[model samples]
Target: MTDPTPLTSLSSALADVVARAAPSVVSVHSHRARSTGFVWKSGLIITADEALADEGEVRIGLPDGSTVAATVAGRDHTTDIALLRADTSIAPVRLTRTVPALGALSVVVATTRDAPSAALGMVSVSGQGWRSLRGGEIDARIELDVRLRSSQEGGLALEASGEAFGMAVLGPRRVLVIPTATIERVAAQLETRGRIARGYLGLGLQPLRLDDGIGAMVMNVDKAGPAAAAGIRQGDVIVAVNDQKLSGVRALLRTLGPASVGRVVDVAVRRGGEPTSFRVTIGERPEA
Candidate 1:
């Protein structure tokens, strides 16, 4: 046997990761009602927007078993990330990196009042887009491919090297963690103004279905809308709206909604891969 024993302990890496990340991982308990007007309770601690479908009150249970009331500070429905501030002060996890490039190994840990669950995976792609949460939608999302357990939905997603990446967000079958890079950017805005500011494009656009490959297609450009005003055509295959790149239908929706009107954002698209650009002056989005 080549050295039956090693000097370092077995759980060293895990222990280090936990030590650095545990403080930020909080236990979220929500008060949702049963159909009968009686409270039939189910619990999930969230660091993601799905947990805050409607902005309201929630009880955050700390690792030390102290529970404090937290209010929804702000929510980016398009990105599926929500910010919650405790009624009392607690130490927060500092975020360092915002983007997880393709092939980056990362770990996810979710804990209930009982146990903690962990899983590992690599970043399949790196980009911001949108996703649907319980009652709302998330935009400018950072998508990942880690397969998350049912218990892992509201937990933390940490990089293998022990940095806090983002919170374990969601997907129907895949684990989507919000990259902390974007979170810090939005959180600053939320902390200052109580909400996230997004650049909006006025018209509704759909993903273009093509025989060659996947891309975004514009179904309609609202009359006198941002796209119309900017001279964007109905058949435009949106490659990039603003700084975020577009790959398909999902990308287009993620970029369009929640974009603030009057903000000037760029739109890069490929009309048959020829590559064109537009200066879109986003207009106001009507209230839902």
Candidate 2:
């Protein structure tokens, strides 16, 4: 027999990797959503929170054409990770802490409603830790140069060596891989408490450009919230927090991440054009 060409070798290697990882990848079904999920532990599966239906009967379609009922153990929308509790014996994927290098080849082993599926792509962008738009702290920024369907949003992003690295989720304009570090952190907390604790100021803010700098004007204040107790009122234009000048509305919101809970900070505001400062204690955001 003639030796396989380089192209044939590459093709066979990719197929082998997909075959090795496809068993742990399952299709998640809900009343209004169908997404991919992977066995994170013996009885827990992790999937994309954005694709999971808020209220529905959830089931996982296994590799052997079997389906099992699952319940929402926890879900964090900020990081877009959801944990499901199911009675499944599917082997959990052995994931690596390796961050995908930029331009490196990768594979997403996922599942459709019927069977296992695969998407071949490359690591388009890789960078250091960054925060999401919803103020979630992601350990690394890994974007994939591949087209993924809505049903395949929560697939397993893997290395060419068949080593699973992270869970792939849909991003605004690109496919994002939620690295192992983030999944380990958020999923642990969710499994323990069923929710991630985030800081809250209880003040609705709008961005306003002042003569000196940008300010966030308080549009509404929760009557019994921390800001109200600190004397922050509606129409008060907040100029700074902890002496750091305000950048914009989004910036202010980002500061209220999990680490800010119970922390005290100086909030400077222009009330009736009078410079006033209030020491406010950040509180936990109430569950929706």
lDDT of each: 0.59, 0.93
- Give the Cα-based TM-score of candidate 2 against the true structure: 0.93
- Compared with the true structure, what per-residue lDDT tens digits does model 1 show for residues 58-110? 77666666777767666666555566666444455555565666777777766
Summing lDDT over every window of 10 consecutive residues in candidate 2, give the lowest-scoring window. 109-118
**Any idea how many clashes model 1 has?**
18
| Candidate with the greatest lDDT versus the true structure | 2
Q: What is the lDDT of residue 248 in candidate 2?
A: 88
**Model 2 C-alpha lDDT per residue in residues 1-288, reported as the tens digit of each score:** 999999999999999999999988899998888999999999999999999998979998999998999999999898999999999999999989999789999999888765889999999999999998888999999999999998888999998989988999999889999999999999998899999999999999999989999999999999989999999999999999889999888888887887899999999999999999999999999998
Candidate 2 all-Cα RMSD: 1.8
Q: Mark the 10 consecutive residues where model 1 has the least summed lDDT.
A: 33-42
TM-score of each: 0.60, 0.93
Per-prediction tally of clashes:
18, 0
Candidate 2: clashing pairs of residues:
none
TM-score, prediction 1: 0.60
